[model samples]
Target: MSIDAFVIGIFFVTIHLLANELIPADRIKRLRWLSFSGGLAVSYVFVYVLPSLHREQHQLKDYASTFTMESELYFIGLLGLLLFYGIENSVSYAQAKGFAEYHAFFWLQVGFFAFYNMLIAYTVMASEIKGVQAVFYGAAIGLHFIAVAHDLWRKDPDRYRKVGRYVLASGIFVGWGIGTSLQLSSVMQSLIFAFISGAMILNVLKNELPKERDAHFPTFAFAIISYTSVTLALKYFFEW
Candidate 1:
């Protein structure tokens, strides 16, 4: 995708998120859903479909053919897993909170991350150097997992959900270490982390978030941002 298009997409997504999270109204929920759907549909049509149409008109192959089908399928699966967990968590939260208030905001976050990863993957595909692409992709996945882990850690430490989070983090780092040594496909490495993290997050948000005695937004945000920044910096400087 063009940088301009990507920036515009992010802007729309940011607006959707801010609206859903900060606004309070019955219509806000419906508006947020419509906005999210519209954003994703527009992005897919412009970035994926319109290009294919142009390719057909010019009798040229699809430019995105450079992206492996396996990778794309893996990303689709990742999206499905995330959506499943998101819906599941939303239901749980709705039951506890007596409304579907945060569901839109939750989905906004998911859409934002999905769009962010799509851009990152597009950038990786555009780069000709395989080594640099691998490092970049790996670093992105690593930072994502680190954020997931830190989010869990900021919740009540003694909560049973914390155990699941730790297990998920263990699986991620173990998979990362193995993928690093074996030079596994970036898509597969990302899936390994995605599944584990999604499962853990779903479990915690469902079973623990409602009853947690020590949940703090500041701590969660701090941990996620701090770890992500450190991971990104290390990936850039250490090439690991």
Candidate 2:
């Protein structure tokens, strides 16, 4: 595995642990949006801008070094954190104002964004693969979506609101299966996966958010497990 991949994987795992287990829930709500936004800015600088700068400096061979900055993975991670903060705050505000249904879609939107960006990050990291590797990758992604679906199923009543998420998950699973069967190029597979994942997250955030807080811990656990499982699965699949 490339240094970039290794670093990214580690960063994901660390953050997942921190956000899910280490960080106190009370403090999480108090987290500032600026902190997340600053992280996003740093991520953009490292993942997107740094590589280009390094390439210009004729240090293209150190691409892995540039890529391993945790920016790519953390971009969406911080975004999800921000969204979570936003939803919680919005919900609290709405409740204070007696607008229960006003920001009900906030939670749903957060879930969708998290799932979607996670898929994109996964695809971005998935640069090469063979048969079993592809299957494992697909399965890992499918499982994450399944987690999201389970969360949705347990929460909302609006059937129509959940439809898009389900469709997005199913589409990616099917696309991944087909891509694996046909032995598609890494770039093609990644692009297709990224597109679907981005679309799902974007649409869900734009549409609605979820309300219930009972599933927060489970959702956090699922995300951490998903990240770890996918990394281990990918490593094994590649026989690395």
Candidate 3:
């Protein structure tokens, strides 16, 4: 567990550095990789995370009696979706209304995503999911993080370069530190994973489905179909 946490934590921070500081955005775009990466992310969320979340709901059945554990956990995922949607769109609305001067929206984004990263870090570090499953999930998230770091930098290059980058990058490690040191109860852990799963859906789609962005459909399609197929095949073959 410690080794997994350490590897994920260190690798996440390293990717942020590459995405935010080391690489030029145009060259990054020219790589034409985000779509395929986004597809892998969406595939994992749909094919793996969502199922795990549902199973987790069952695990919490004994403790929560008011509502079906399934519904409650799904609600957590929905709440995550709405919260991030508001955070992202609110910033855009503020910027569009000539309110960029306030900079509050920008900072709000920072705070929300810092927490977002921490949530994911906590979930990944502490969850029982391991081996190939863990690798698939982690790879998808690593790609997703690059998109996020790139977006934050684009939003306010000066601020992100000056301070925001480091702040966001550190969030993963902070969450890992907390998660490793403390074990959350089963229900709480399940809820948190559901929330992160929801957030991942929103983050990946918002970046990939933008109308203004040029998309490589073939690459994207290939990623989704192939990864999904591989995951399915793995399940059937390994009976995992």
lDDT of candidate 2 vs native? 0.41
lDDT of each: 0.38, 0.41, 0.79
Q: What residue runs in model 1 are displaced by over 4 Å at the alpha carbon? A: 1-75, 78-83, 86-135, 160-162, 177-240
lDDT (C-alpha) at residue 219 in model 1? 44
TM-score between model 1 and native: 0.29
Give the higher-TM-score candidate: 1 or 3: 3
> Of the candidates shown, which would achieve the greatest lDDT relative to the real structure?
3
lDDT of 2 by residue, 1-240 (tens): 444444444434333223323433334442232233222322333333334333333432345664455244334344544655565456456657776674455455544445554454455355544455444443343333333343343344344244534444343444333423345554344334434433434323332222233224344444445545555565567643
Deviation (Å) of 91 in candidate 3: 0.4
lDDT of 1 by residue, 175-208 (tens): 3233233444444434433443344334334433
Q: Each model's TM-score?
A: 0.29, 0.37, 0.89
* Candidate 3: stretches off by over 4 Å: 21-23, 29-31, 64-69, 100-102, 210-213, 238-240
